[model samples]
Target: MPASHSSYDSGDEPRPRHVAIIMDGNGRWARARGLPRVAGHRQGVEAVRRTIKAAGEAGVEVLTLYSFSSENWRRPRAEVDELMGLLRRYLKSEIADLHGRNIRFRMIGERDGLAADILTLIDEAERMTGSNDAMTLVLALNYGGRQDIARAARNIAESVHRGLLRPEAVDDELFSSYLSTAGLPDPDLLIRTSGEKRISNFLLWQCAYAEMVFIDKFWPDFDADDLAAAMDEFAGRERRFGSTANGR
Candidate 1:
């Protein structure tokens, strides 16, 4: 189909260069199946692997996933432990494979809050795959949008106090550089699973103009086709970027 506006009407359909996802419904999937939530989480890991491959094949340059949120610490101790254990195992087993595939692995969030071992593994993964040029996979662990923005604000204030930056110099671009996702493009598309419509603190500032797609399938059941379908939906959108149809 032709683009709604001629401003960006190329021969090929519009595709999102950066896609962010909020993987939800794992607990619900497990509870409905009478299985422990951990089982659902494990299956969700498989879905993550599949989506990585699928996204790369689909020409997506950057993929960001909302994994463990900071609020997840409020869950029961035993469950949290299980989740951490799974994270550890995933890091250990998947890093080498991802590196071999020429994919860059990155994690964004509060590193101090993560266990020492996990932090070590994350550093290693980032270091090993730092030069990869195929695709970028970003996992948001222990992340909160509000916390990220607040941290950026604090850093900006510090810069001004130190005379390194003036209060008048702070603009949208300067403020975004202070964020954890500095140097990365804002997500062009955002997807949420399990029929959810809320953003749930995934990417508040970055997704200001992202096309939001919600799927009813639970996260554990998500696969390559679902991602492809979401892409198809994305290709059909006309991003005017606050411009009117006549302007485009």
Candidate 2:
């Protein structure tokens, strides 16, 4: 596991290298305002833009957003289609801007189920932003924690069966490399909006020791101040990471 950020003192509180967020409550926000759900999602996209700027300004090396989950397929087909359409539009509109900002763009989770046109756009965005080194923005689409783990396990088993990797050679690091987030640092902090406390099947393995901050505001209402507040909360906590506070 990576070193825990909770060990740092106040003055030495290093910015989290990677921050993952579960952007929640778009529908709830819309319902509360008597607006269509897609309106909230549209506003949520604006929040995404602001948060990206905030994270980059805060010196976070990587930002991962849980954009869509595998289980979200259970929603009404119209809603799903609307979300997909929004995603397509976002990619088309934002890729160039992201690349210009020197921000690397990446997507994780299953890709086979996405529409062919969406896949093509994703590929183009990734390729265009591949060389940028300032920071990375990772979107978890069609992702599930259990599914990710299962896929990694299957891949490892196949490698071993093919005589490419010995069973004894399989360890935590090797196993992690087989996961979707192979090259990215584990999240130092994870924030979930709308007061939800659970991880919701996002980054189960990678967030083994990440600090979590839950807020009452919906995704569309989240702003730079809220993000700063979360960071402040993170800065105040002490992370023991299974050891004594004295680091014994």
Candidate 3:
């Protein structure tokens, strides 16, 4: 276990402002129950709803979910189609509710490959919730960390070529501004369900210093308690950010 923050003053122990989750194991969860994988994916949506509510209650400012990864496109066409349909339905049904709750809905990923209708729905959701400040729910759809980085680099190169930016002005801060998550705080805590210890090409740049917690439960089975437990574990860590314990 890491050092606990309990000994510090309440003001000294700040809760994470941003959290990212890798929702995994949906297929396995369905297989275990002798059901179709889509069944687990559907249950995962419910889990997502539960998590959003839980996160709000827990004072999280931003919640980023790995809804669909770039590699997921390689899955069976039927499964991919089902996932896309789920995303479309979720956007249509939840955007209004999210706005009513004062939660901003944002999607981060490559948008060109998505269906035209899905893109339109995404645009509407973002426009509707753009002014909300209660919290942000960022869905990482068709996203990949490496690809994000590559895209940023490409953008920077193009800018430099066009004489819009000097090569000397390029740095970490400038580079990050080009990412899909620009203007958002980096995640302080990252949680991966299904007990997977790897990052799986998610948030490679943004989560550089995040405290990671891996849970054995499948994503569909995750609940508020699970999130609470992970947070409790996070509260026990001392983030030095490359500095020593003595703050040297």
- The lDDT values for all models are 0.90, 0.91, 0.92
Superior candidate under lDDT, 1 versus 2: 2
Quote the positional error of residue 43 for candidate 3 in Å: 0.3
Which is the winner by lDDT between candidate 2 and candidate 3? 3
TM-score, structure 3 vs. true: 0.94
lDDT of 3 by residue, 22-129 (tens): 999999999999999999999999999999988887778999999999999999999999999999999999999999999999999998789999999999999999
| TM-score per model over all chains | 0.94, 0.94, 0.94
For candidate 3, give the lDDT of residue 85. 97
Q: Show model 3 residue runs off by greater than 4 Å.
A: 1-12
lDDT of 2: 0.91
lDDT of 2 at 107: 96
Tens-place lDDT digits, model 2, residues 1-248: 11232333233765678999999999999999999999999999999999998887777889999999999999999999999999999999999999999999999999979999999999999999999999999999999999999999999999999999999999989999999999999998999999989999999999998999999999999987787778778878887777888887
Clashing pairs in 3: none
